[model samples]
Target: MNALSIRSIHGRQIFDSRGMPTVEAEIVLHNGVRASASVPSGASTGRFEACELRDNLAEYHGKGVSSAVNHINTPIQEALVGESCDDQWTLDNKLMVLDGTQNKSKIGANAILAVSLACAKAAAKAYGLELFRYLGGLQANTLPIPMMNILNGGAHAGNNLEIQEFMIVPVGAHSFTEAMKMGTEIYASLRNCLKKKGLSTGIGDEGGYAPDLNGDEEALSLLMEAIQLAGYQPNYDVKIALDAAANEWYKNGHYIFPKLQKKITQSELKGYWEELCQKYPIYSIEDPFAEEDFPGFSELTASLGGSVQIVGDDLFVTNPDRLRQGISSLSGNAVLIKPNQIGTLTETLSTIRLAKEHGYGVILSHRSGETEDTTIADLSVAVNAGQIKTGAPARSERVCKYNRLLKIESLISGSEYPKK
Candidate 1:
């Protein structure tokens, strides 16, 4: 029953896509197997989520994470070395206590999450189990539906559009592979569609084209055209999803659409989404209000919850307490899970379980700024979340998760996805 004990751990500062320094942690076992994991940074972060440590000095323009790296290398490493890496909870608990804060403020979520995930990788490797199996046991068999974001706006894009992400969901596909094919085809058609319109193909943070469009309706029009161009029926073969990420552009107390050159109140925002649902084949809306606007979420969900998904990203941030509060307020019907937002694999899994137990849908998501780590792919499968949002089918970092899912689908040949 015994194998290799965790021998050592270390961390260092690394650069993320935005040329900002982030944390990367390495864990080594006694038998020489080693694993290293890096945390992804988010461009549009929630106000309530765990803090991502940054040096306020001139270096990296106040985005440096040398403090986090040092935290991992010294006290955290000293406490974690010689512990069983397989005891993910115990390890994460140590991290929680060491930080001794609600949001991991003392040590930094960036440092703790990197070490937590790195130890998970090392444990799985040392135990000779695939990461999914290691985390989910035998029930980790189903593949998730891909939510491919093909258009970018708001904080994630340089364009003036208010909505942050415009995605295509291939929900009608029978299998994960087929669903991925549908998304890729639509993505390609969208590229050609942009070219025909004399629009630039320069992509945003998540690899979707960031064109200067006037409003959200233009995005819906382009997506429908792309689906038709790819030989698929709108709302049948593919459905539209929007991540408004409204908190990013929420100024003072009003939601502003610079592209539309207008500002809207809570009732007006609700009317706008209702109109969108009527005009387009929209299936989901994320962060339709600011993080603190629970009543807005409740009213919108009550009116539209019967028809489509109302997801909370900034509203929940994958925190159990926030999710619990959301459940009480009827804030959202679904939640977006980002591990870094909560700061540990154990906490992330707990949050997912909590959301699912309450009949809320779970959307495993990727950060706007990311690395080549594909752990989120395995975690998605491990938890059997029916949906995942890992950006578009461009860039090596974004595509790596999709490619890992492809390989995983190959491994379980006789399995049927879409879970009964």
Candidate 2:
């Protein structure tokens, strides 16, 4: 048996859904198998996440990724040309050490992630195994329940709502297919309900309708109505989640709700979440507090962690060290997993392993600014993350992930959490 070495690595600047440029890398093994992956951009990115390098020149409104593309072809290329393709950890570590930055800014986390994901694809292709199998071992077969973003507000769209994402979780569905079907149905019903009420059905970035709402409660109430109208029971057949993206609205030790024309202190925010959990079928709340307020996170978790999933995205940035700290402090019960947050699959996997070890749930996520990349679909299944936060079933970029999951389900065995 001969070891397959990396033959060549190259990258190019491509456009994402927002028409902004991003980096895409292609890796070819000596055996002629080639794989490519593209990095997605985030509109409401965390400060602690790895730096997404951009060419801040006069071109493309400084959104150009030409510099990152260059990093792939030169520095990244030189580092991995003769490396073995199967040892993903070794190849990824080489990139990390080469950059020598905590945030992977030297080569751009975008460039590093593109190469990292592309390398994983190349290995999976060489082994003739599914990408999820390559990453999750034999036990990686379950499709994640979709946390479909149906009402986009805050940073995801040009709306007056403060909540970042209002999601629908088909908790009662037995299989991934059923859950997805329920989501699509509820989505259509919501659009119809909006149209009947003479409300704007225009969508936000994540394909959720972005009508000007009075406040977050309005969003929740409408979703509940839509669930019953769609012939599903709320809190039983389906549930709700919120990605407050609190970092977007947090300022000066207060959560500024511009729509409500008020500010919420940490205690107020915690009380508000508790009230919502009790009133509605809310199952999860993400970034419910400011990013740096670890104690606030801990307080929210301590109060509502048993009843709901208090997930930390901006709080931990998917960094293992930060997650470890959160565990010690009892900040959150689940961690949102975004590969670009840490810049490599190895690190992303490490975070998932650590979170699982600490009894924390994992939710694989996608950014608001996305492309037609289905890598995250495979990733969710590979890690059996159990939940995925992709946008609604509207845009081609968003639907590509759902379509990929449907295909994966066609190949794998039956579901573990079959519809009850």
Candidate 3:
């Protein structure tokens, strides 16, 4: 292994035809190996209105998007200037150390995560191995799970009901075309089912729900029908999950926990959940209520214990203090791990370990405003997370992560490893 000299680090603003900002980071290796990662800056026009937080940390800190891009480029390039490519761990550790002291509060967690992902990609290419195999051991096969996203109701309720909910069907076959065909079939079935109920077929960023299908039992029932029609068999490899993203709506005196408790009667909520578990075999639910509702979380956990996972994202916010409280109180059974929430890979992994040890499932996730950085893909395999929740495999940015996972699976196809 030759010494790895950081050639140059650069950033550029790429946009979809709609003029949305997708920031790309490029790191050139001394051996002429150039690797890049991109993420949506969440600063695009008309995007913020659809989300809960008007400004992610980039806006909160008053730093421009370029600041984060530069944070990743500068220190990482300097740290790896004369390091060996094979010393990936050592290099990553060194960068983590610098980030801890110098850039602690500058650009927030996104910078460190972006840098780590770029380095991981470069290292994977150097070894001619897929990123996951390089991070985690091989598995007999990759399993596909159903994915659902919180599109409306509560905080993300914009007038336009793009398809906010999603079901991810992982097609690990060698042929991308075949995988896409399967996805299309599943989507068509779901759409037909929704249409039969006179509901909208679009979800996530595609289509909105009907005005009458507000966040109630009726809406959920329609969703259940659509999922079943999509040929999804609950619990037998077809697991169901929901991303509430409810915290976004609680900013201005909305008080989600109490409202959820009041709006959704316990019996009704429990009945719907029971039906979901029995019908679709849902395995996980994220942010069922507002972030601060610890008591409500405990009640839900106690009620639905061992039946499914209750995941916390906005509640924990990557803060160790909150995680400790959640664990002690039995608030939820899982934590959604997003490195950018805490700003460093070291801390993120530490949280994952802590959660696992405390008897909680770890789920690696991507933000709605995401980049092409595939770090979460590797981290999911590395940490053996219970699952990974990126958006549906529709857009290129979202599919890019899934595509990388497929490559990882290919590299370790025949290896005997325990399921993660």
Name the lDDT value of residue 350 in candidate 1: 94
Worst 10 residues of 1 by lDDT: 411-420
Error of 3 at 415 (Å): 6.4
Task: Give the winner by lDDT: 2 or 3.
Answer: 2
Q: How well is each residue in 1-420 modelled by candidate 2, as lDDT tens digits?
A: 235789999999888888899999999888898989998989988899999998899999988999899999999999999888889999999999988999999889999999999999999998998888888888887788899999999888788898999999999987878888899999999999899888899999989999987778999999999999999999899999999988877877678886666877778888988999989988899999878888988998888888899999998888999999999999989999989899999999999999999899899998888988899999999888888888999999899999998888888876455331
Report the C-alpha displacement of residue 346, candidate 2, in angstroms.
Answer: 0.3
lDDT digits (tens) for residues 1-420 of candidate 3: 353555666765455312345456666777888777654432111111111111245543433355556665576566666666455567657765765643345433445555556666776677776666665545424323314342334333443322123343332323333444444455565557667767654544422233335444444555455545666543442344565554543445443233334344434544555565576545666766567777767877887768778888877865566789999999999887766566545567678879978988777776666666777876777666636676655566567766776665555545222231
* TM-score to native of every candidate shown: 0.97, 0.98, 0.74
Distance from true location, Cα of 28 in model 1, Å: 0.3
Candidate 2 TM-score to native: 0.98
Off by over 4 Å in 1: 258-261
Candidate lDDT values, in order: 0.90, 0.90, 0.56
In angstroms, give how far residue 92 of model 3 lies from its true place.
4.7
User: In model 2, where is the ten-residue run with the lowest total lDDT?
Assistant: 411-420
